[model samples]
Target: MPSSAAHLLSNHYNETRNEYYRQLDTASRNGGDILPFINYAVQGFVDQIRNQIKHIRTEQLRIVWINYVHSRFKTLSSRKDRRRRDLLLHISEFGLLHKNIIGVMALKIYAGKTVTTLKRDIGYLRSEELIEETLTGYFPNLKALTAFLPVQRRVVE
Candidate 1:
């Protein structure tokens, strides 16, 4: 269960973000009152979501995605500009680990660029040392380069 404070804060942040989106849309379409403050608030909310997601378990990412509703997730909406770098890092890292577990099967998932985009991202990730493929297709990378990324399972447990 989430702490009471966490629950309340999440609720508050979500509501505030939605309000800002509504305001921004109205201002853009109808004109007037489209304050820069609305944009700033939306950016802050997006950052908070990104920061919080960084702390979440991989398995729980889908849960967070499901529970959180924002313009960010809309099919036609673009990703936030500031998040591009972080997202690239995540996509690269995920691609690498995916290769490790799934072997050549990873080729099918491709990260970007083409139908093989996931494969391309993983290839780049290996070059960056975020992960490495011991063999051409199936094998765990000897070391993971993402030292700061939280590992889902701790050995002590």
Candidate 2:
């Protein structure tokens, strides 16, 4: 597996772990029952983590694609701009991890990139794209990089 894939899997695992912690924190603050927390620790947490592990490969490919696109912006000079790019990557990775059709939509409503912007970034990258055909086996649509872009969001306003 590529290092990019591993990083994505790690990020997924950490997200799951952080969510679990958040649940515990919320419960503690609310003075909720301890029984459910114990059950979550013993069964829910383990089962969720196991399920995530089962689909690690799919998650890896998703992140690898994002990483490939992100690599295009490696020369960004402004810290603020780089942070925005990093946040975009993080949201994209999270949406991919959810494995849902509306994942990117959810991200957009929560302050993620518009699909057009993402596609534009991809187009920008394509002008100087360096990925070779051999990478396709590892990435579902590696030969056509834009195929990995998230679905475009329609502004309601």
| Predicted structure with the largest TM-score when compared to the true one | 2
lDDT of 1 at 28: 80
lDDT of 1: 0.44
lDDT of 2 by residue, 1-157 (tens): 5553445544544667886677678789878867765665555544544566657746766667787657756777575446445534654444322223244445433356565654443344334443221322111235455466565455352
- Local distance difference test, candidate 2: 0.51
Off by over 4 Å in 1: 1-113, 136-157
Clashing pairs in model 1? 110-117, 110-118, 110-119, 111-117, 111-118, 112-117
Clashing pairs in 2: none
Over 4 Å off, model 2 = 1-57, 96-157
Give me the candidate number with maximum lDDT.
2
Model 2 TM-score (2 dp): 0.27
Which lDDT values do the candidates have, in the order given?
A: 0.44, 0.51
Residue lDDT tens for model 1, 31-139: 5765665665656655665556655654354344322222223443433322322333444344433334344333322332342544554555455443445444322
